[model samples]
Target: MNKTTVPSAPYTRRPPSPPQLPYPIFLNQPRRAGSRAEFVLTPSYDNVDPGQLTAEDLAIITQNQPQLVAPNVSGDWRYEQRREAQRILEFLYIGPHAVIRDHDFLRREGITMIVVARDSRLANRSMASVDRAGGTLGVRCQYIDVEGPRDLIHGFPQTIRDINDHLLSVYRGQMQEMDKNDRLLRKSDPPVRGKVLVTCESGNELAPAIVAAYIMSVFGKDMQSALQFVGLQRFCACFDENTKRLLQSWQDILRARASVARARTPVPGRPVPEAKPKRRLDQLRDHNDDEMGLGECTMDRERFLGRDAFVPFVDITNDNAS
Candidate 1:
């Protein structure tokens, strides 16, 4: 759907501490690493018969996989219908830019971080107040200086990293605090809580793309799964053909990287010697033009000029030659 049809945060009182969400915040955090292909293999939702799943494999899958259905987040009858920040996962919310300054909403939801992705062309008002609002609310605000929705492809990798890194760091800090407190009080550790809001002017294009990218990378999901999950929570989010193609390329890049990891991961009994460390691919590298399947229009030269500017080549060898 085009923007012609659809319609479109900061400042808080209370403690700077983020509130704990209902679901486990560390679902995507792998407990172990190296040659754990079983943990990283993208699940196939296809109609195929796997022999069976082991107890350990099943445990890992169940823990990491989030329920993709819309959450029963509130008692409000119109919660899903209203224009609010969608809790896509236990820890991630995707919604409009208006929530940045929403003090009660932020503290109530336990949101600690706000990621702003906007385009100048689509900007109707200045976002200079974003930082001031976040500061007041005591929320961390990170900006993605993108041209617009279409330009968000360039920021996907970094945005995903920013979100993941922050969440992990928050979890580690909580763990350290828990360890220190437990030594004296002998109390159980509380849940590690950190939530990041990914939003743009309307939460339709740029924000959704970033959310989908995060879901894809952190959850090892393909394009379809990621978008569907986001759309279910926030129906208004839109991705045009060009944006979809860009994500398709991004998925391809991720799949390629996952394959390499699988190969390097050691088998149960065998240990692979560590190779020299290489530069990390923290950015989504551009794939070939044909990868996006744009070659189908190569022969339709007239379409490029204008559909009405249709021009047929003459049969020079025949009498009908021009």
Candidate 2:
């Protein structure tokens, strides 16, 4: 017989709780009457801070500003000529209705192609004017009509590409004609000697954007530089926010495409070997170095510098012997 008794659980004492703060805690106290009065009496520009202008105010200001008037170069047509590159025989002549109205000027300037960048209605009207002028001038008209400025902005990249392709074809045809005439092709000279006319409703915004796009695509200039170049040629070549954003978007697309193309192209050299996995510390150090992005040392002794690398030695032995 075993007398087994369960031992009673030992009593455990809990630690004492921290003291609580008084119930009513005031986060923000009222300002003094004097301070409040001073704030109320303070004078401000419409109670609006200098850096606190709303978007609506900016828009209103922009709207209220007087629109710049481009110089009337050719009647009501609003024309201006721009030459991008000096060596290139062709120049970009931009204007409004005056381009189609004046046939003699087109022929005299040797404008072989007329690009109409406007709505269908305006384009058709201009085309009709060109028709009335007659085909005797031998100036070919091309209509590239989008809905409005926004539509033109969105579709600008493709539109410029198409126009450039057409121009290239025209230049190629001229080269073939030159070849047929048994002319010696000079590498230094432009293949085509024809000029191009780019026009829209008004040669202010849309036309300049198109010309800037052309310069960006053909000459590999960035959007800002192209815009600046075009602006220099045309006084009224100002772009709105939407148009500028579209151009920037198009430029980014072009750069991405170029990078992809370059990546796809095979390099004419041995393939690089895959690097071995580095230690954790090495990887961390490498990552820090990459983040710093320091340029390569130009003063490296192994680097080639034709004359700078060559150290001149004086003939001291001959002088000592003498």
Candidate 3:
């Protein structure tokens, strides 16, 4: 027994294995209300290891969690290239960004006016760009600021009217200047004398509604037709159902106003009679004029020639007298 005890291993206990962690150690931890922490402890028994998740998988899982998502920024941040209308010449443009972002493109396209369909704050920013560009571009930039969607709907009729009036006034001023300078006018019917960019935060709903309303106002198209025409120009142009109804209501109002205007407007090619009672010719005549000279020449012929001077007369004996 003493011989066999030569190399008996010293009595030793194997080191204890690390304790296995619960599938997700934080599963039972309480989450704070409204916490924006990205990681959420979700328990699963499918034998999938948390360490096995790829970055993309983790990202997708995190994205699925509502608390960690970010809010959307305004549409102004999503700038895009200026798009011209297909039905109209570059007279009208639609865009998501401010005109200042595309100053060069505007200069190249001869955009003289910028109709910014945004709130005051956003419009002010765009207006600053317009002012900066105006100094170098040698052109005046006009801006139109429309209130947000609700206000726009409430004031749609007046808003569109005001915009049309501004456009007409600017275009007329340009035409007058051109005429004064003896410049050749652009030959397009519904002349593209003024280039206006109608824009909103995203150039999505409000801008399109305004543009469509403009089309309906200027081009005499129905709301549906106007929207379709705008859609043709910019495929993304659209309006919600409420906006469509507002537009339709506006169209009705416009039609009513137009009818009233036509009724009030005197017919062309015929002069309107004066509303005041007419005065007699004698009452209108100036009595002092008769004293000066009434239907008679006032020249003094006697002073030019003596009273005895005789005028030459044709005679039958002229042939013999010569």
Cα error, candidate 1, residue 106 (Å): 0.4
Candidates arranged by TM-score, highest first: 1, 2, 3
How would you encode candidate 1's per-residue C-alpha lDDT over 92-184 as one tens digit per residue? Answer: 888888777677888888888889887655456557557766777778888787775567777777787677667765655544333544652
lDDT of 3 by residue, 1-322 (tens): 2432332334445985544322111213333575422222232212222223333443332233322111111222222423432222235667664545666777777766555566755554645565676787655555556555655756555555555454555454534335556884644544445466666666777777877776555444566655555554455555666677777776786566555554555788978655678797556556665577641332334376657655333343554567
TM of each candidate vs. truth:
0.59, 0.51, 0.47
For model 2, how does the per-residue alpha-carbon lDDT over 160-217 read when each residue is reduced to its tens digit?
Answer: 6555555555554544325666884544354545467777766766777787666555
Clashes of 2: 1
Name the best candidate (by lDDT).
1
The regions of model 2 sitting more than 4 angstroms off are 1-90, 120-126, 175-192, 270-322
Which number leads on TM-score? 1
So what's the TM-score on candidate 1? 0.59
